[model samples]
Structure formats: structure tokens, C-alpha cells
Target: MNRVWLPVVAVQGLWLRSTLRLASAPGGGVSGTVPGPAAEPLRLAVLGDSTAAGCGVTGDEEAFAASLAREVAARAGRPVAWQAVGQFGATSRRIRFRLVPRLDDDLDLVVLLAGANDVLAGRGPDLWREDLTGILAGLADRAHRVAIAGIPPFIRFPAIPATLARHLGERAAALDAVTREVCRQSARTTTFLEQPAGTPPADFFSTDRFHPSTHGYRLWAQDVAAQLIPDQPAP
Candidate 1:
């Protein structure tokens, strides 16, 4: 089946600057006055699994976080500093263990792209929800604006057993539902992007068929940038 995925929307450049200013006030570590003519870049924090870490991709530029930073800089007319905390095979549980203690209130935006590994590991949906909730709460306590990317359908990928693909796809959909509910309940965050299931596989993924290829990361970056950037005309 041909699945039609939503094209990512373009965001306004100023949004990045505003987010940065909020994250780096006088009280916080971020310093220097917000740029007037030249908008300051946003400070983005990404936390999650191998995908967020750019596992299949070769270099940093190919990583979603890095590509996002570049896109924001290009459109925002300023620089962006993105901090990514990702681990291969990391589940929401492991991410909570690693990222919670390190969080600071100075972060402008936080992206939570996770849960695939959890499903692959046969983790329960309730457990995934619990861990994800904890992570969101922690970020809120630190006073950061957040966005959660829905777990895309993985069944279409070249990897994984065809029998397992259907099951995995269902699991991913379940996780996406939970994520949507969590984002709805949380006032501090938003779920601005959704990568739908059943889309034709992109060549951007790596040989493992698990992680994004440079092209894949770039497409992901475009999706993210559409949401994170301020209002820009649709492409």
C-alpha cells in the first residue's frame, strides 16, 4: 500500500532566536544579549535512540540533530547549538537513566525521538509510556519547550523479518498513540511532526536498514525543521 506522509512545514527563523533567549537568560549559563538585527540561534537538545544518534548515518552532518541545526541556521540567519544524547539500542527507560540528571533549564528546545528500540526489545507499551512521561516531566521541571516525534512505521524497512514487520508496525503505532496523548496532556511540549506508516522506504537508510542514511537524516531534518522553525510558507 502507498502511504502518503505529511510534508514538513517551514518555521519562522525568529522562533529559534526567541527559544535561545528564553533558554539563556541572565540567571542561566547562556549569556550575551539576544541579537537584534541578526537573530540568535536556538539551543536544541535531542535525546533518544540510535536514530537520534545517527546510528546508520556516517557523520554528524547526516545526523538528524546536526542537520536540524544546519537547517535552522540557514533559515534563521543565525547559528544553532544542538546537544544530542543518544545511544544505540537505547529504550525510553535507558534514556531516562542517562538524560534526566543532566538536564538544565537553559535548553531552548528538546526533541524526544525514541521507542523503536523498546518495541524491538519487546518492551510493554505501558512501560514505554511511563518512561516517556518521566522524561517529559523532567524536561518541564527544567522549564524547556519540547517536541516529540512519532515513531515511524518500521515494517516497510528492508531489515527485519517480514513476519515481525507487521507486529513491529503495530507496536510502533501503539507507541505513537501514547506519545500523542502525553503531548496533549503536557502544556510545556508539543507533537508537531508525524512520520506515517506504509510510506515507500527511502534510500537514506543504511545497509542495516535500521538507521537513516545521510539522505534519510536530511529528510528527517526537513521534517523537524518545519516544526521547530517559526511560521514559514508551505513548500
Candidate 2:
């Protein structure tokens, strides 16, 4: 361990404890079947960490995956069957090791929200890339389209100490860069980099100030759905 990181690690431990107590655990998986008249409903899977599991929000409807499904359904005029598989504090490697093996086949889309935990855990970009290679390869083989959402803006997260925020922000940016490269390398993948969208901080973030609130989830879903569903042809 770098000697300079010692104090940061100590602060991180404290922050981690506080985050756990304040941010709800990502326990039950999110799943729903949106009804439609299409012959085959769109099959979607979301895999990643706390945000993908919807740590800050209550109910599946309020989470990013479900909100995205609703948006896509409305755009495509078809039913969507979506499911989310994630856990709190899951790094990229953990998702590859644990979540990838259980993913269903014949998925139309798979959305991945990772990297923040990897950055916070001090994992380097190489490891992040290796993990994503495995995760994306699996999803690419199984799903028609794989979408990679950018890591959460840790620097802007209200729960983190200002002293540590700059350092964390740098790491998050590095990880997001790696994420972008991974997506770019694959033709089937779509990438979304999270940035300030002019939405009020209080409106988007939950009480924990780390994970997204329902409104935040909505914003993210809108972007994801737009990418998944292209503009319809003129009638």
C-alpha cells in the first residue's frame, strides 16, 4: 500500500461504514414484465453494483432498470421484460465472477453500471479493463446490445468528504475512461458518461447522497432508453 494512501484509506473506512448505515442494502433483485401486444417482449438484464441494484431508492419502478424498461417500452411500442442483478460494493471483478455466470440467454439488452466501487477500492485501470473484457464478452455473446453506463460522479456525491473528493474524482474519471474504451472497442456496446445534467443535486440524489433517487434514475433511464431505441421512421 502506498504510504500516502493510509489516511485516505482510514477516511474511506469511516465513510464506508457511514454509507452502509445510511444507504440501504441492495438485497432483493429487481424484475418486472411490462405488458404489450408484441409477439415477443424485449428481454433486458441489468448487471452491476449498488446503483444497478438501486441502493438509494425503494421499489423496482423507481430504479434505473425498471424505469429504462418503461421508457423503452413506450418508445418501441412493445412489452419489455427486465431484471436487475447486483449487490452493494460489487467491483467489476465480482460482477464478472458472480453475476455473469447467472445471466439468462437470448437477452435483447444488458446494461452495465460498474467501476465506482472498483475505483473506490483502489483497483487500477488495467484490472478494470480486464474485468470489463470478461463481463462484456459474456454479455455480448448473450445479448443483442450491451450498454455501459458511466460510473457515478463520486466527486459530486455529497456523502464523501471534500478532502477525499478530489482524489476519488480523479480515480473515477480514470475508470470511466477505461469503461469508454471497452465500450468503443465493441460494436454492440453503447456508452453513457454521467455528467452534470442541470438537474438539481437534491432532486437527483437520494438522502444518502451517494446513490440516485427516483428522479435521478428517471434521468438516467431516459438516456439509456434513447440509446436503445433509435428514432422512428417518418410515417
Candidate 3:
């Protein structure tokens, strides 16, 4: 059973934490518009962890927020004004308390990338559900629509040890399941974006071999754009 590898996994997890250098979170782009057909730009806020912060890339433009906003703008034919709000290793609980309060009620769309930090912290399912539910509920009151990113398949991440990744992957799936259920309950205003399938290639990661590179974020944006735009316009 996989439990036999827990010792090795624990050691590898510790080693990775000590040796791998984490990328810094990027900032700027207070206001701008992605040209599209609509008169008013679709205001977008990309929130949560490293994914939202675009940690592995050189600048904010190369991160997920800009890429996803552009993707949504192109497909929806609406100019998008975007903001990237995130911390490098924040969990859902932290985002709920720290970032969620900073948002205004005028956002047209919100995409949250969370749960990986919770998984790494070994947070329990009940707490994850509470934190995630709080995050979604708070955003629902602010944004016209709330879309959440499914946790990535850690087992496929080249930087992670297979034994540890398998465990984390299973946990990620559990958290994703909880998130999907929460979204289902609020089907009118919230949607869950599933993580892309298949094993990730080397190019999917940055130089740190941990966080996503610009290439990976672009690919993810394409998938998110296709899924989010077709939903009914939020009231």
C-alpha cells in the first residue's frame, strides 16, 4: 500500500521545502483594458495563491490573471479590466480573511485558484470545506460571477516526488470534490473549473521546476476562457 512510502514521502517533502527556491509574487497593472466588442470592459479579479500571483514568471502579464482576462475578453467580445490579487503560499482560510475583504462589489468576474497550500499544510477536509465555502460565499456577494480553479494533479508535477505527489494528488482530488459540491449548490452565480488532464511536460514548469511557467499559465487560460464565457450572464 502507499502508506508504506509515507516515511520517504515525508523526507522528500522536507527536502523539497528546504532546497527549492520559491518564485516571488508579481505586481502592477492597476488598470488596463483587453480590447473586445463590448463597450465597457469586463472587470476581472484573479485571486488565490501562486497561480493568481503569477509567481514563477518575470512579470504580471505572463501570469494567469492577464492571460485569463485576455482569453475571456477575446471569447466574450468584451474588453476586460483586470487585477491580480494573491500571495505566494496562501491557503483558502488565509485568502478568505486577507484577500476577500479587499475586493469591491463592482467586479464582473472572479477566478480563484486555491487549495494547494491547504493540501500541503495537511489541513483536514472539514476545515477546507468551511474555508472554501466562506471564500465562495464572500465573492458571490461581490462579483457578478465567481469561477474557481480545480486543484492541479500533483502526481504529475515533475518537481514533486511520486510517493508524496500521489498522496497530495489524492488529497487535492478530495478538496476538488468538496469545491465542486459547493459550486453545485450555487449553480446560478458560481462555476468550478476543472484542472486540465494528462501528464505535464517539462515546459509546464518554470526554472524552479515547482510553480507554473508562462507557457503553462497560457494553456490554462485557454481552457478557463472556453469554459467560463458560455455561462449565462450573471444578474
Question: Where in model 1 is the C-alpha error above 4 Å?
Answer: 1-37, 103-105, 196-202, 230-235
What are the lDDT figures for the candidates, one per model?
Answer: 0.66, 0.79, 0.84
Per-residue lDDT tens digits for candidate 1, residues 58-156, read: 555566777777776676767676777776777899888885566556777878788887876778779988998888777766536888888767666
Worst 10 residues of 2 by lDDT: 192-201
Off by over 4 Å in 3: 27-31, 230-235
How does candidate 3 score on lDDT? Answer: 0.84
Assess the local accuracy of residue 40 in candidate 2 as a C-alpha lDDT between 0 and 100.
89
For residue 8, model 2's alpha carbon misses the true position, in angstroms, by: 7.7
Error of 3 at 79 (Å): 0.4
Candidate 2 on 38-132: residue-level lDDT in tens? 55899988889888888888776888888888898889888999989888889999999898877788898888888888987889999998998
Best by lDDT: 3
Q: Evaluate model 3: give its TM-score.
A: 0.92
RMSDs, each prediction? Answer: 12.7, 3.3, 3.3
Residue 1 CA displacement from its true place in model 3, Å: 6.0
The lowest-lDDT stretch of 10 consecutive residues in candidate 1 is: 21-30
